[model samples]
Structure formats: C-alpha cells, structure tokens
Target: MGQASFACDPAQTRGRRVAEEESAFRSCFQRDRDRIIHSSAFRRLKHKTQVFVEHEGDFYRTRLTHSIEVAQVARTISGALGLNTDLTEAVALAHDLGHTPFGHTGEDALNALMQPYGGFDHNAQTVRIVTELEKHYADFDGLNLTWDTLEGIAKHNGPVGDPVPYALAAYNALHDLELHSHAGAEAQVAALSDDVAYTNHDLHDGLRAGLFTEDQIAALPIIGAAYGEVDARYPGLEPYRRRHEALRRVFGAMVADLIDTSRDALAGSGCAGAQAIRDLGRPVIAFSDRLRGDLKEIRAFLFQRMYRAPSVMAQREKVTKVVEDLFPLYMSDPGLLPGRWQRDVAQAATDAALARFVADYIAGMTDRFALQEHARLTGTHVLGDLT
Candidate 1:
C-alpha cells in the first residue's frame, strides 16, 4: 500500500523555478494540483471540446469532465502501481490545459495559420501556459510549479526528440526538463490514464450522439465481449443502462490490463528509484498486447464512425473556419484586441512575435467564447444549426 521507491517523493522535490517556502500542510505536488484546479485556464475547460464541441450536448464529455475522468483513472492506476497519486493526478489534470476551444480541429487550423511562424502545439502551449502565460502570482508571470510537475507536463508522452515545439524549447532554454529522457513514474501513469479515459469516453459520446449504434460497436473486440457479458447478466435491462454497464466494463478492462501488465513490468525491471524508471528508455506502464490490439480495433472503428463521420466533419469545418477567421483577423489589426492585450501587442518586436501573442489569445478562448468572438468580429455565424 505504501508508495514504491520508484515513485516520486514530494519531500525531495527538485523545487520550483522561483524558490519559495514550502507549504507546511501540503506536499509540493499537492500544491501544484491545488494551483492547477484554481487557475483561470482550468475554469475555461468547461467550454472546450473533448470529442464534440461543448454545446453539442450536455451529456457529451467536455474537456473539464474528461480531465476529471483522466485524473480519476490516474489515481487508480498510480495507487495500484504504488506511484505518487498526487503527482499523477496533477499531471493528468494539467494535461489538456493547452487544448484549443473546438478541440483538435481548432488546433489544426491554428497550426496551419501559424506555420510561417514557429507552429502551434498543444503540448508546448501547455508548457507556455504554466511557465509563462498564467499571471496571477505577484512574484512570477506563471505558476511556479515544482520541477517534477513541469518535467512531467513537458514530455509526459515520452522524450521530446529533435525539433521540439517553440514554447517547450524556449522554456527548456531557461529551465531544462531533461527532454531526452522519459518522464518519471507518476507522469507515465498520467499519460496512460489519458489514453484510457479518452478511448472509453469517445465510444460513449459516439453512442450518445447517435453517430453509431450500440449494436454496431458491439461488433468491435473488447467492447463486443463487454456487451455480451452485460446481456447475459441482465436480459431485459433498459438501453441506456445496458450501454453504460458494457462501456464501464470496457473501461475496467483497460485499467486492469494497464495495472496488471505495468505492475509485472515494474516488479521485474529493478527500477530502484523514479530516475531509474525514466532512465530505462521505455514505457513501464502499458496495456498488454492483446488489449492494445483490441483497443486498436476500437479506435479504428471510432475513427471511421465518429471522428470522420459526416455530422462531425461538418462541425469540424465550421470550427476550423472560426479559428482560421479569427487568427488573421487579429493579426491584421491588433487594434481590435482588448486594451489589456494592446500593451503586449505594442511590445511585439516583429510579425512573428505578434503572431505568437495572437495565437496565445486565440488558444485561451473557450468554444462559446470563440464562437462569440468570431460573430462579434466577422459579423458572420460560424456554427450554423450545429447539433
């Protein structure tokens, strides 16, 4: 039940960028988690996209709900693997802080627009937000998170090979995140938790959106078996209940495989400390090959049936246009920007610097706010009769 030696211990934390007195009642990771939960960016996630835009439906997963689910999954995985749950939870919660309003669609659009500049990456934007953009504290421009949390956020997916995104690269120049190595145990757990949460909920959202039927997904691998098991247990269960039961089981299957496979790997790997886990140059947390294959099938099905479906594609185009419209509009006329943004706009040395600031403003917008701004500026309705 106790934390493993390979878990990151907050007491020996590498400390924040701007050193401060440690909290008497909280670990550094706990403070990081608390700061993230209370940040302005975190509050804006309620209107950001997951699979669908925020206004698509009340029941569909928003970025905020998806983050909470990922944090929940991370804690469960971290607890079972004897990793630091608080650190895992913090990384999980902060993982999507840089996502744009309309989700990947908006990001894709913004990236294309900024291609002449240094390109936009959600991961790099996340580093920018925590280390620079967030400006609540009097002492620092950004949240002065512990070195461990920043490292986890910088490369939770793995080593940041050549050509790292601009924001991450810039920050690493100031405070190195050890970009060539894997993140520590808790971060690895958070990354896998993101996979587990999104894969499961995308199915749930697809079903609820009526993009695909439960019977159709019942043909998929792990999901079909889950559906079959539910039918055997309760023959006449209602439709929604049946769907929920089967999907919950599918979720359990992913979490369990990750825990079981990862625990075996950890127990055998001889990683005596968190650094050893990072130094191993491979993922210590992962689903078994069978589950991975099953998940592949599920993901392919969802890609074809939900993500690229006609209705979703229509919505994607609309939001993409909104971002496309907003970016150049702001660039051509920084005068249109609010008074607070004007000082920064005036300070921009070059078009590239100005573009980065514009991207930052656009990236911070929520879906509804983006829509409102697009309407306000362009005087054109982007989301037309979107469900």
Candidate 2:
C-alpha cells in the first residue's frame, strides 16, 4: 500500500547522527530494523523473561518473542493505516531491548539499587543501548540510527518532561530529539501494538500456566463475548481448541479496534504530514474507550492472579536478591567485571560513573548468565541453567 500523507517518509528522514551514504536497496527505516535484529542487545533478549521467569517454561513469552510479536502486530497496524511499516517494525522490535534479565522485577530491583548513583529506567537504557553501548561500528559508538528513529525510541511512550532520563538527556544534548513532543505516527503504532500483543499473549500465557482458568477470564468484558462466540461456533471443541479459538478472537478484537479507531482519528485530524502528527501532542493510535476500559479490567485481573500470585512472588523475591547481590559486588570490585568491560571501569572518574558502568554490565546480562554469575560469585549452588 502507498503510504499516507502523514506517514513517515524515508526520503525525508531527519538523518542519522553520523551521516552515511544512503542504502541503494533499502529505506533507512528498513536498515534500522535490520540493524536492531542483528544487535548484540537484541540477541540477549532470547533469555530475558517477561511475566514468567525464563526457567519456568519454554512456551511463555520472553522479551525476544514478545518483541517479534509486537513487531508483527505493529506492521499489520501500520500497513492498514498506510503508515511506514519499516519504521513501525523497527520501533516495535527495539522497544524492549533495555529490559533486564528477569523482566520488570529485575528492573525494579536494579533501579532501587542504583538510586544512590543515578537510577535505572529501562526506556533510557534502551536509548543508551542503541546510541552508545553497541560499539561494533567504527564510525560511532551506537547503531548511529537516524534522528527520526531515535526520537521514536526515546518518546514513543510519550514526551519527556523535567528531569529527563540521564542516558536520553546525555544523548539528546548531542542531537536534540525534540523531547517534549509526541513521536510520529509510526512510533505511536508501535507503542499501541505492544499493548495489543502483550494483553492478548499474556492472557494465553496465564491460561497455559494455569494461573487463572478460562471460565474465570470468560467473565471479563471483551473476553466474555469472545468466549461466548467461540462456544456458539465450536460448542463441542476440545478444551485446548476452545481456549485457543476464544483468545485468538480476543486478539483480533484488539488489533481491529486499534486500526479502526486510529483510522477514524487520522481521517479527522487534518494532518498534512508526519511533522503535523508529531505536533498534535496526542497519541493518534489508541484503542476505543470501550476497549480501553475492558483492558483495564483484564490488566487488573492479571496483576492480581498472574503477576502477584504467591508462586510468582516467591520467584520474584529470589531473583530480586540476585540483582541486589550482583550490583554491589561488581561496584566494589571492578575487577569482577569481565575483561572486555574493564576499560570502562578503569576510566571511571567518579563513583557514579563507575556505578553506571556496573549497571550497564549487569543490565546486559541474560537471565541464565545473571543466575550463573550470582551462583558462582556468591557461592550459591543453584540453577546454572534456568531451564
């Protein structure tokens, strides 16, 4: 499909921080997407857990799987809206690169530990990874992504206000991201697609984990109608088939709702171009009010039954201790960090700078690596492979 007037045009991109000859065979956004796929940080997402710990089950969504799903959903939404699917997919896939090993639990623990230094924000860490940490390139420290992609990465969730995140602030000072404005429509699509993918897939994972029953979730708003529709159409279906059919419908409803609602908004918004969309100061891509309310109920249900279940909480405590233990040890003995990371520690001019190096090293660890390191360093004969 031809892109809409308000779609981000690769030809008109704000350009990379470090200028490079344009690719003859691909758009800049496509190159950005390909770069993210090949990134070392992206590779580590394979073992980064989301709601379920990586060791608990192979079927549950790791950050890698979730990112791929979000990218898929974002591409569909972007295509339907005649937005730039490449940019959308790039933003979607790169969105979670900064997530710590054990997911939000680990991020939270690490943030608390680093509070004395500068604190941790996964979003900021994501920006850091793309802009600075990926040092493979000879021309620059990071992937050296275009300004458009950088803005999308930094502000996809929304605008940055006072006390902007340290990593982002540092980078933005070098190349301003227009921090107090909404990212373009493609980024907005990526952000909402994250919601759609997670809400739908988390329901699937929750059911598979037996954290909550199908009958229980069937009582929730949008899901109830979905279950009812599945029951009417496939009355005698096997339990597995019934659940799968109903949840697929739920997923369809979310994607459909997002596309339809955003299509209407775009038609009415009088946006002349992508820049106009950015200046609108509101997310044009979003679910309808009805679906938004339905999602709130679903999320609350998950928070109680899935996220905060006793078993999950117990695992959270243990993993939290892993981060807590890892940070200070690495901080006190910079020698403990791997040899490759030693150069950063030796050059540290302050305790805070050294702590940041430690944060960067620990934050990059995969779940299994973090667990193994914790066991080896702290003398806990635990799961070497959290499988």
Candidate 3:
C-alpha cells in the first residue's frame, strides 16, 4: 500500500494552523478549506447574486447558497471516489467569492470597466482575493493557502488559455504539466458539480419566482425526465413541494452520474486507485463518452430555457448597468467610499491602484448595497456614475 502524506479529521475541516502547532492543526487540504471559510471574500458571497438578484426574493439562491450547493455536490462525488472532499468543498466555496453583486451581469460590467487594467475575471480575482487582496493577518497579503488548493482555484479552467500567476510556481507548473498530460479528476468534479447545481437549481429558482410555468419546465425533455424520475422515486407530494423535491432529484442524478463516470474512466486508464490520480494537475475530468453526452444535452436544455430567456436577459441588463456605473464612480474617487476603504483611498494615487481598489469595493458589495451606493451618488433609483 502506498503511504498517505495527509490525514483527514472531519471535525477540523475548517480550522486553521497556527504558529504554535502548524504541524498538527489540519491537513494541507483541510487548511485550504478553513482559510476559505475565514476569508472576507467568502463572507461577501452572502450578498452576491446567483441566478436571481438579491432583491428578487428572499428565497432565491444567493451566491453563498450556490457555493454551498456546489460544495455539497463536489464533496459527494469526491467522497464517493475516495478523493479529498474537504478540498473539493473548499474550492467550490471559494470559486464564486470574487463574483460581483449581480452575478454574471455584474461580472461582465466589471470586465468592461477594468479592461484597461489586466481585465476582470472571477477566477483571477478569486486568486487575488486569497493571495493579495484579503487583509486578515499581519504576516501575509492573501490567505496564504496550501499549494494544492491554490492550484485548484488558479487553474480551475484547466489548460484552456492564459497562464495564472500562482503563489507557488512549482505546484502551478506541475498542475499545468498534468493538464496537457491528462487532467485532475477532482478539479473536473468540482467544475462539473458547479454545472450540475446551476442546471437544476436555477431552473427551480426560476419556476419559484414565477419566471416560468410548470408546463414550461415540464416541456424540456431532460429536465422533465429528471423530474419524473424524482417523482416516481418519491411520490405523493403537493405541487409546490414537488418542485423542490424534483430539484434535489435532478441534482442527485447529476452527482451520481459524475461519480460513476469518473470512476469508470479512472478504472479504464488502469490507474484506478493511485496517489498519482489524486495529484491530477490538469483541469479535465475523464468521463465515459455516454455521460459526457448526457451532461452536454442537459447544459444545452438549460441554455435554451433558463439562461437565454428574454425575461431573465432583461433583468440581467439592469444588473449589468448597476455594476458598470457603481464601479467607476468609486474608482475615480474612493473618498466617497464608506468605512476603512475610504482611509486607504486617501493614501493611494494613480489609476491602477484605484481600479483595483474599486474592483475590491464593488466585489465586496451586496445587490442592495450596490443599489444604495448608486442612489447616493446619482440621486436616482437607476444606476449611474458621478463623473
């Protein structure tokens, strides 16, 4: 049997390592999970949008809930395969910490606004949050996470394009090498788990918000079948209750399929249970051809019915404008900012720092807070920038 370098302590999953007992606090992966939990960026996720705006309703999935759901799905798959559940959960939790107030609408606006400065990417900004932006301890700039967790977040997109400047170059380089060679199954699980959560949960949120009718939801083939399977599996629920039950059923199926497919692929590769498989440096998951096709079909159905709907797009437009206006006004003159950031603004000069400062500021706000800031600056309910 191969020796295991780390130990798992479920109770200490989110505890940090201090100077006194840095050797025994938690596993490297566990420390990564804990660091994410304690970071300011993670806390800000509570206010960010998921599929619906924060004000859309109290029950809509905020970025926090979305992160939690993704973590749950990722851990389920990872645990099923004897992978690192804590690591997967941590990565999933921190994945959206850099998301702006209004979800992707805000993200798009931030990208446009910050295009001149290295550009804005939630994934990139997530790295910045842990390694640079966050100010928790006196010794470091970011969270000072473990090499593996940092790599997972940095190369979450895999070897697609563009290189991330990781804090640990060796680990980063190793991960990059692994990607071209194959891809990390755990990272792939985390990525696809996100898709699974969004595919089913967003549809559920939309239906609950009155954005779509039962007939509309049931009309989509993949979604309908998933719902039917759930109903048959556990019947005798009221209509309102059925939607939530169906959502769980769909998510469960996605998780199950991902785990089974990943296991089969690993088995086929003749490296079913090896430490080498765990160190999958790349960002791809090797799924059987059948499961891949099914995932793609499910994604396509969601794109047609949920993501691209005119009603949703219209709201997204409104969300886009809110972020676009709020960012620049604060960037140009952060003296207008509240709390400690205003003090930091008084010390900085030049546009780069200002842009980053603004990015940090905007990224930290909730949907309501962003709106309020807009109202305070523009004197109108609509979003705007003051010079």
Q: Could you give candidate 1's per-residue lDDT for residues 44-118 as a string of tens digits? A: 999898768777678888899999999999999999999999999999999999999889999999999989999
Error of model 2, residue 244, in angstroms: 0.7
| TM-score for each of the candidates | 0.98, 0.98, 0.83
Q: Better model by TM-score, 2 or 3?
A: 2
Q: After superposition, how far is residue 336 of candidate 3 from its true place, in Å?
A: 1.8
lDDT score, candidate 2, position 97: 94
**Residue by residue across 330-365, what tens digits does model 2's lDDT show?**
888999998988887899999999988889988999
**Lowest-sum lDDT 10-residue window in model 1:** 378-387
Pairs with steric clashes in candidate 2? none
Q: If the candidates were sorted by their lDDT against the true structure, best first, what order would they fall in?
A: 1, 2, 3
Question: Which segments of model 1 are wrong by more than 4 Å?
Answer: 385-387
lDDT of each structure? Answer: 0.92, 0.91, 0.68
Worst 10 residues of 3 by lDDT: 1-10
For candidate 1, list the clashing residue pairs, or say none. none
Give the lowest summed-lDDT range of ten residues in model 2: 378-387
